[model samples]
Target: MSPVVVLVGPPGAGKTTVARRIATRLGLTFRDTDLDVEELTGTSVQDIFVEHGEQHFRALEEQAVATALAEHDGVLALGGGAVLSDASRALLREHRVVFLDTGMAAAVARVGLNGNRPLLLGNVRSQMKGLMDHRRPLYAEVARHTVLTDDLDAAGVVDEVLRLIEQDRA
Candidate 1:
């Protein structure tokens, strides 16, 4: 199987952009868990949150992660909360996982005040901070490498990840 790299981070941490560049540079396929989940469930994630609940959405997220891990050998960008699930964490441990660490301020700035993010609907700043507090440690736990994305562009982050991968290989 081709090598797999899993990118984990909170929303707006530039995981998708970095993953896309890394996948392109490495000549690997790119998969986004959110996109796949939406495609599979025939519903947008925000709608899923509105119709069901976060628990149900997380279930789909877990399934999406599993499917991506099993079927794809490339750079995969996981939903911000995917690592909250124990099963997802376990699966991630089996592959090369990179945590994109971006501060809440930067994340909020990047994501903006988007209502589509159910978790960030009301009091987004506080919610983002709280989520980061809870998720950052978990991400560090599963990450084989961590790249601070505070001021880095997508290409810079990709280069950092590539260097980390090379170091790990060595």
Candidate 2:
């Protein structure tokens, strides 16, 4: 099955939240690969990263994304670094990928320096900056559309994504 909309972005770019709205608007189901990974492993992502490290987490993420992309013909939200995997990027090529972009300030405001995030432990802003710098190109490469979410609420993001998809169809 092919997803109607596959959202890819940085950690706090509102992919999960906006995906839900887009799914509802389009009468499609919503699936977050991150949540799926958690459900499959019966553990939080933070714990996975802390205990087994990023490589292990990425492996799980790869499996989760692959399964979702294959089985779900709806809206799928991938983890921030899920696109880093070459296999995931290849899978994304067959679907309508939307990159949800947000500025560092807005992302920080949304996510904060919480302990729940394993990557932003020492310095949130710096970590986010580095992630953005590295992953921006990858996101652009895989995404058919990019929606800026810094100034938009969840509803606004959903509207923009819908408009972009409609434009692409035309």
| Root-mean-square deviation of every model | 1.1, 1.0
The whole-model C-alpha lDDT of candidate 1 against the native structure comes to 0.90
Over 4 Å off, model 1? none
* Every candidate's lDDT: 0.90, 0.91
Lowest-sum lDDT 10-residue window in model 2: 108-117
- Native RMSD of candidate 1 (Å): 1.1
> Could you tell me every candidate's TM-score relative to the true structure?
0.96, 0.96
Candidate 2 local distance difference test against the native: 0.91
Quickly count the clashes in candidate 1. Answer: 0
**Clash tally for model 2:** 0
Query: How far out, in Å, is residue 2 in model 2?
Result: 0.5
Instruction: Pull out the clashing pairs in model 2.
Output: none
- Give the TM-score (vs. native) of candidate 2: 0.96
lDDT of 1 by residue, 1-170 (tens): 53468899998998989889898999988999999989998999999999999999999999998888899888899999999999989978889999999987799998889987899888888989999999999999899989999899888899999999989889
Per-residue lDDT of model 2, residues 43-140, tens digit only: 99999998999999999999999999999999999999998999999988888999998888998877797888788888888998898899999999
